[model samples]
Target: MKRIWKQVQQTLRILGAGILAILVLVSSTVPGGERLEQVRAYTRGVEFDYAGWMLAALWDKGQQWALSAPRYWDEKTQRQVVEDWAALTREVQALRAESARIFADPSVSDPQTAAAPVLARLRAREAEQARLGALSEEILQIQTRAVLAEMGLTYGKQAVPSVLYRISKLPLALVVSPREVIRQDANISLLPDMGLDEITALEQRVEQELGVSALVVQIGGVAVYPAMVMETTNLVYLTDTVAHEWTHNYLTLRPLGMLYDASPELRSMNETAASLAGKEIGLRVLERYYPDLVPPPPAP
Candidate 1:
């Protein structure tokens, strides 16, 4: 693990330096360099994730873990597993929301850091996550592939076979706002494996060095980035986001996606086009699997 991390760090340094230059030059002279930074972020895409170089160094170990995991959900119990997962996930979200509400209370001594109550809430969250993860593997496998096949985005073994992942995303997003603004607005996506502390430190360093507004957004389902392991009991979003990212993967090989970095308008076009296609594809999945959730087509 130590050796792998060393290699990953070396790669990050190289990537950050190279990409930062592109940002500094691409319309950096503009008002606050926000658009330039946004371009730099979007163009870089998920280079540190699934198709990135860092994972190439550790794919064998990662694949071994993924393929070797034991199955907890089968065809017979698939529906039950999904239903249970959905319940637990909602419970977890409620607990998190409560915790967030508590932290946001200005009356507290310090909300930025976790307090005793927050720690208790964290424990509850972890318990719910453990239950959710128990049956997640089988559920994700069946659901993601079904959506992919329904959307006609499948590849044989020769092209690419059996993508099994053991973890969710670890996106280290470096969000930059216009100097004239006060909040985060743009970002460059980082590797899925980067440590939280490491990424947070980088966010701070970048902000201080560049004298720009910067922060790290450590969340998931971001359209601009790639997630290694994507699974959710929320069928609606799960189907839509999976198709959305895959559309990006497809576009990367075409003319529009290839020249994404050359112009701002081109990047917008790529996102807009992918969104429309993904919505259509998501509707197809809805019609087949969960007809009740399907929205009626617009008036003709």
Candidate 2:
């Protein structure tokens, strides 16, 4: 038993090293090495910690794997968890709005006092959200893998890169374009918690200093290993984004994804392919597991 445990630990260590190497290689491929450095200088302190996030996500996955928690639950229980997660997300959003209203009202002398109950409830809901969020994410990953396997988008009954993701606050992307031409020069990730004012300020500074067109874009998902999926209440969007990122991972091992930065045309092809495949896979997952949530066909 002890030897088996050690082997498991060794395997995970090797896997961690491999994932780190892949991410680093991809980062090194950012167009214009010097230009990437320039962008990094401005984003030095505020850059998203990819390594840290990956480690945290992997640790969570390891915990889940050890317990095999989702396997214990039947299909019905899994569906219920997903539904509850969506409803709880809405409840949390409404609570946030109420809390904001109370705090923002000029007539309220003691906003904190008035907002105390709402805040308390918000905290409780958020805690529950975290719990359900983790479980639901795993459930969705398993479902997606099964669907992909059926579609023959798998090898040896497993996804090529494996379906791993975490639904959390996603990082903001800083896209740089040449002033004279509308071309992407650099794309970098910023810390997730940055506010609009900070995002605007950074974009302005980068543009002014580099004489380039810059935009801070909110991405629904990023194709990182254990892909970074944005937290959302919409199940359809969530599932679609997950599959979309997974497609990117799938393509990464092929010539298409390998040459993703080869040309603007290739970039378009890669994205279009992912988008199309993601929607199809997402729809199939819904049709099989969450049939009620699937939207009806359009009028003829």
Candidate 3:
């Protein structure tokens, strides 16, 4: 028994040493450990006093909770919703761009004739998109509600979340490597490269030429992490991603989220919780709305 206890202690010591070594490497000039100095520089004396805005978010969430529910449509109307809505959104975005370009001049008086057609088109697109957006919201809300029921989570005087998903890639993104996020006011960069080698070479050049450590983080999708809230167009991910973000918002009022910046572990915990919950919520959406896509339930 004594020998067994000694072995247990030895195993624990080895684990701790391994973790410490990894941390040192992460802070060193290794491929996977490149963010060490950058992270240190970014986090120096950071106050993490995000409560001011988080409170606003909480209040807005309450208001959202009290809002009227989205109108549901029959299956006939729901068919081809994703493809059709995406097309309309593209048209709407184009019209909006045209309107802005045509109306950018302050010196140009009597712009009505030139702007009327564009404005009319914009209005029509907006109207149609709003209707379709509402239907999508209804579909998502069903999943959100189902997840809440499954997890015994409380909406807490909040009405159903307005998960009115639309695919709108932000017009611009300043892509970065190794998860060094350049974000402001909910805007983040998207990877704009045509192939993996481009981003990989960029990261390699950043490290090799700059004498720093940066390796590709192996992210292989249109979806960005944590910052996916920046702007998204994929409905398949939008539902769960929105839930993940809202979980962060919900955790804002709790000790867990508040202490997010206190340590890496807490931040990981917070994000992990959000991701787990978000995936579950997305699965609920599939189960309830896209049953055709769901796998067969297990037999007794």
Q: Which candidate leads in TM-score?
A: 2
Q: What residue pairs clash in candidate 1, if any at all?
A: none
lDDT of 2 at 190: 86
Question: Candidate 2: where is the Cα deviation over 4 Å?
Answer: 1-31, 298-300
TM-score of each: 0.54, 0.89, 0.44
Q: List all candidate RMSDs to the true structure.
A: 10.2, 2.9, 15.9
By lDDT, is 2 or 3 better?
2
Misplaced by over 4 Å in model 3 are 1-87, 90-127, 155-233, 294-300
lDDT of 3: 0.48
RMSD of 2: 2.9
Could you give the candidate ranking by TM-score, starting with the highest? 2, 1, 3
What TM-score would candidate 2 get against the native?
0.89
**After best superposition, candidate 2 residue 27: deviation in angstroms?**
3.0
lDDT of 1 by residue, 1-300 (tens): 885675566445434432332233232212244554544543354334423422332343233334433233444466556567777777666767777787888897777565566667768877777655645544554455566675556764111222222335455566676578665445565666766777666667666666677766665444322224344557676656655655664565468766665555776898788788768776676675567767767799
Each candidate: what lDDT?
0.54, 0.84, 0.48
